[model samples]
Target: MQIKLRLMVALLGLLSVAATAAELPELIFPEGVGVNIHFVTEHTNDLDLIAAAGFKFVRMDFSWESTERKKGEYTWGDYEELTANLEKHGLRAIYILDYSNDLYEERVSSLHAITHEEQRGTASPQHPKSIAAYARWAAAAVEHFRGQHVIWEIWNEPNGYFWKPKPDVKQYLTLALAAAKAIRTQVPKAKIIGPATSGFDWPFMEEFLKSGVLEYLDAVSVHPYRDPGTPPETVTEDYKKLREMIGRLAPGGKKNLPIISGEWGYSSSTAGVLQEVQAQYLVRQQLVNMLNEVPLSIWYDWKNDGLDRGDNEHNFGTVTADLKPKPAYVAVKTLTHELSGYRILRRIEMDPKDYVLVCVNGSGGCKMVGWTTAKAHSVGVEMPFKSVHRITGMDGFGKGFTPKVKEGDLIFKVEQMPKYYAFE
Candidate 1:
């Protein structure tokens, strides 16, 4: 009876994969907005808040050290539960196949065995046997989760301290290539992406792209983070340059690789940015990515990791550690709910400071979101609305007002914070 039940579950998984396999596109938007979360089980309530905000994906680390306690064996029970919980909330998973297993190279005891400052996260799989073991484990994982809308990333931030003992492109590529090859050989339909580099390290990215790894990847994932004062618009040119580099380095069939805004966000630390500014940035960031045609944009954090008001790392969350909704949380909830099923139609730029994004939904409803990085100003935009529509602020607070019209154009106020003007 146990064997029969196991077979039934396996069959169901296969059936689920078969059903959704064909609908997986190279680029998806609005639906691709996600958040990076820390827990899989403990704070299950976070999933409820995440779902309420209309988040479609959750990016989390599927740690290797915890899974492969005994060499040649894997315990995916924790991640299985994580994925199951996410699925129940209508969320997808972007699992980072991360870190070195302590059972192999370096022979550390556990994930928390930190000796010194530099030796932190240095338990990387460098040995030949360890590399092979990691590859086998990756293949086994892909085979096990053969479907159900999970995207696998090879490693996280290999260009930074996450690689251990300094970042080496060659060393990272060796492990990545082996893992990618192993996963592809088993689960041919699996969506694998890699070189999840920290920030936009061009040299490391160019090296990784030139190494012929694109053949195994479905998209180019990156964490395009800028300074606290810098607006998210600064990433526009970087995206253009990265696309060009991908085109030049990728092989024939894989030249037009899509980009994923894997992990990025602003912290509302007391010493740095304001919570209100962070709120504005969150909405702008998602809109910028959507306009640039980025399939997925996973905000670095869903909730603050700690209560420290001065610690930058602890304050990137959209919500507080106690599950209290911050302005950023309300902003994201408002943005997603307001712009659901809408795609950017065009951008009408009047000047360097004025930015207007015309979006259209499936039901022929037109909405415009406009903002400015500089001082507040007004711009005239031609639309099809005959009556005054409700104007919603970035925080989803506003009122109905008739705008001044001239020559079949509606004048819109573009301020630091984005506002949605629905012209249905």
Candidate 2:
């Protein structure tokens, strides 16, 4: 009887595997997924660091204050240097045009002042002339950087830190539309993204959509940063809400406009629980975005800027100031390497479990199931019962995995790896 029971269990497992295998397909790299970095100023060297860390794309801010401090007279020397460097290393730039030039001090101060009312009065859309001037400047900047950078984001977190008046969705959209129109006129082919909001700015987003603000932009941008301790289930819901908002804004495939998580990260410095939760959160978020077909999920600030490396605000970077890889950093590098050259086939959400089963198709007729945990859950991959692959830094290659299949799954657990992966 015991022998018969064991046989039954084995048969059931085999049957399940066979059934899944018939429907399973190889995994391929999803289109347009990327990482963000702040290499515009102090950490210019961090550009190479990011590239070395295996990131193909990087996002940086082109400060209006820095580029055109004076009116009509523009300087591209600094920008030129930065772009030239990125080009040399085969990295793509996603430039965000932020801050107001001194000429628009009244508008900048009024719109972005600490007090909500002061910011609103200063940044009122009534100042169409000033807004138009800024738009014109953006156009000139686009012309200057033409053919060099393709993705240009209008502003950073306009509904939050970027906007001083605090969450005036309509006014922010108005400014964005003005910028978009001006940019479109000059660089018709340029892909413009805007209204980069942080957290659950759904209320502002709803208002923007109601105003038909999405019509002017090519893509919607968001910065979804949960507290470090927030569970993966909550984060996933946040992204879902974001997607729903985007869908309502542009329905019926009218615009298959991609959503870019332009800024996201968790820092150890915030709290002890956050430190533990952030590593898993980073990994889970990346998997969710990719599986759901969000084009880009760029992390904020690749390197620490302050003296306290673990302080939540200062420690949002994937690496320390001197470039030591964090656990979150390792996880991203590993995932990117493993899932490279493969695109997502489909994602299945499991309720109560708070997990997702991501099936991917790739060359050589290989199928991979990426089990993404919502909180801190764990699972092993079955089939292809090879050894685990170890990925080192951004430039390092993937090491071979030992033959170990736990509960009918192959296990290829990792923290981070270089840009290239070598399977042995």
Candidate 3:
């Protein structure tokens, strides 16, 4: 009896040591963070700067019209060049398998298709032949880039103007299913996600999810764009609703289905939003998404589309058309660099309109990010161990301010702008 009891205690001690050696979870930033880009060859220099900014992924359209000008042939010269640059910068590609070919549908190109029903052509592949052709192209693209770890997303924002004449969940599903099946069959290991719907359009998404689309998807992708006045934290409820829907609808009672913020951003145009406000939103949006357990968060428009200051679409970029860094760019760089290789330990506190998250790196270092959308107030943040620390602002507001320490808790002034506290 004594010998058996001693063996049990030794086994428990070994288990405890193993648990302590286990690694902490990884955060989504610095790996899953990305931006939308319109060009591949045009902005060669910008690619260098973007990678330097610590953007690990780039979401670009691999349009059918551009790749397949011929009936059944695909010329991947542009995409090949794009992938090469992506590899050169140590960045991954979330290449969108999207848009309709003019020859396959009508002479009207998807670029010319407008929101007006009459003006809208088949913005996506519609005809049977076109659908089959698109599936083949998707499989071929996945096969071509097999070992490169590319994420092939089916159709961008089919629930909105991007769907062409009108949004039809049934039609979109038909094409998405075919393409998904083809990629699954041809390249079984390929990472394919679908129904990249615009916003949290429940009606559209519910119908799409009902079709067992989640069975073929590695993750659900959404462009969660909100009205200019809506705060990023408001997305928490939307994510909750989405998770419930996905849980009820996913095949074989799958739980914890991953959600990706595939594309979302704020415009800095005069009629849209201010650049300074855009920067704050950028950090807040990413942090909110992170807290919600989103695996990937992509910001739309890597650079401003045009010189038109008043055009909302022309000003969503992190950088200007001339490749000048905006406050939004600096905010992202700071977030990624500061929290590199760090993962969320837990939410210390989330009420009182004050948000505090504790993050830890593999090297036993701890950091806290705190902010409040409400009026400025002081919040007590307890550290892992009592120590001297440094504070840094998000977009250059307050830096190097030593907070008052109380009972092993650091008193921080939480305000609209998110700030990072690194324990020394």
* Tens digits of lDDT, candidate 3, 1-424: 2244345434544543532232111243566678899886756788988998888888988887888888878888888888988998988888899888877776443443323434535556778988998899889889988887788899888887677666788889999999999999998877887778889999999998889767777878998998878878889999999999998877874455678899999899988778888887888888898889876788988999899998888999999999999988888888888778766666774575788877666555567787887988887776555445554333323345555678877887787777777776
TM-score of each: 0.89, 0.76, 0.89
Q: Indicate which candidate wins on lDDT.
A: 1
Model 2, span 1-424: residue lDDT tens: 2244344434544544532332211122423445666655445567666665556667888877677767777888877887888887667778888766547646444443323344332343325766777788788888898887557888777777456544566667777878888888888777678677776677877776656656666677887777555644456677677667677666455355667778877666746334434555665666666656555677765766665744555777677778877766665666666666554443434444434343323222233433333334444433421443532222222444443346645443332221222322
Report the CA-based lDDT of candidate 3 relative to the real structure.
Answer: 0.78
Q: Candidate 1's residue-wise lDDT over 1-424, tens digit each? A: 2244345434544543532453233222458889999997756789999999989999999888888899788898888888889988999999999888767777332233213253344367777988999999999988988877799999998887677665788989999999999999999888998888878899999999999889998889999988998999988999999999999999998888779899989999987689998988988999888778786899978999898998887899999999999888888887887788776766886786677987665455567888999988778887645554543333243334555657767778888778887663
Can you tell me which runs of candidate 3 are displaced by over 4 Å? 1-26, 108-123, 386-400
**Per-structure clash totals for the candidates:** 0, 36, 0
> Per-prediction RMSD in angstroms?
8.8, 8.8, 6.0
Cα lDDT computed for each candidate against the true fold: 0.80, 0.60, 0.78
Give me the runs in candidate 2 sitting further than 4 Å from their true place. 1-33, 41-44, 107-126, 251-255, 270-277, 348-362, 365-424
- The TM-score of candidate 3 is 0.89
Superposition error at 307 for model 1 (Å): 1.1
